[model samples]
Target: MSELRTEQPHDDAGLRDWQHVHNVIIPTHVLSLAEVRERAGRNHLEVAYLDDVLVGCSTVRPPTGDTLTATVIARTLPAHRGQGFGTELYARGVARARDLGAETIETVVLSSNEDGLRFAKKRGFVEIERYLLPGDTIPWIDLRLS
Candidate 1:
């Protein structure tokens, strides 16, 4: 196994890398190039590489409004899902959020994603709320950093 490395790619390159991982890991939820560009401008985007190949990606959005919480989202390619890549990406997000002075960290997972729920629970996050959106019921889970 190649050593895993995480990096914040430059704007244009990061968008392409992020979109590629998004499309591969969760095709149904893949973001448009425009959305990827927007996110790169608004969040901390990290791409994980195993040697020279992109294997995962993460986004940690800093708190906004009156909230002291940061939001994290990560995805690893299906071929790499159970190999700890997702966990690594998620941990990086949490660490980044803490470094940014966030008091809490949260992630929203679709109701049907058992693996995501399990991953959050394993990381000490607890389900706080479940909202039924247009096409999915998503659970909001959080972990306090303070």
Candidate 2:
């Protein structure tokens, strides 16, 4: 095991890798490459690797509106969980959010991802709300660090 290697998705390959992790982890909300490209234009997106293996990806949505709220979501592959990749990605995301002048931080998790929900709770995130998107059956939970 080695320290996780992460970089902003600047190339098409990097973008694809990021999108792969995201879509795999959040199967309920699969994103296409073009969708990822659009998100990259507004959000800070990064791909995480352990040596040459893809481990995860993270997103930091900078503070917006009057709340100064920023959103950080780290998605680790099922095979890569319990290896600290998510923790590293999350820490980097929080730091990036603060750097962008965020006053409040939050994260979202798919209801079915028990690991993700547990990860958020262990990090002092309290569930603020849970709601389903249009045409979705499973709900998404929104949590805020408290």
Candidate 3:
């Protein structure tokens, strides 16, 4: 893999990254640019690039108000899936969460997505809960950050 670069994306580029990854992973669940814009307003977003090309993105919505933990969502584009980009990005996400005093980091993976499941487990996350979505059940996995 080429040298990895990570950054907090700005405006339009951030929305595009969100939409692009959403479309790549879950085509049935598309997020409009406007929706991405709205989410960006509420979440911390980061994008990872390999050799200057966007390869993955990560978002973490830190606990606030009634919530006590953070939720992290990360995805790497198809072509860049298993070359360690996701893992690198996740490490940064966890670091950020720790800096923010978050006690736990939660991430969900579709039950059918074996790669995602393994990825989470490999990083010391434990399956803590499961929930049914429209057509699939997802496991809510978490890692202690504190």
Q: Give per-model CA RMSD.
A: 2.7, 0.9, 2.9
Misplaced by over 4 Å in model 3 are 65-67, 134-146
Q: Write the per-residue lDDT of candidate 1 for residues 1-146, one digit (tens) a residue.
A: 57789988687776788789877755446679898888888899988889888898998999765677898887787777898899889888988988998877888665566787787777777777775545533433343332
Q: How far in Å is the alpha carbon of 142 misplaced in model 3? A: 7.4
Which candidate order results from sorting by lDDT in descending order? Answer: 2, 1, 3
lDDT of 2 by residue, 14-62 (tens): 9999999988887778889999999999999999988989999999999
TM-score of each: 0.83, 0.97, 0.82
Highest TM-score against the true fold, candidate: 2
Worst 10 residues of 3 by lDDT: 137-146
Model 2, runs deviating above 4 Å: none
The residue pairs found clashing in candidate 3 are none
Candidate that would win on lDDT: 2
lDDT of 3 by residue, 1-146 (tens): 46998878686876787678766775645678888787778877887877768898888877654545877777888788878888887878877776777766788765656787788887777777676656543443343332
lDDT scores for all predictions? 0.77, 0.94, 0.74
Q: Candidate 3's error at 5, in angstroms? A: 1.6
Candidate 2, position 56, lDDT: 94
After aligning candidate 2 to the native by TM-score, how far in Å is the CA of 99 from where it should be?
A: 0.2
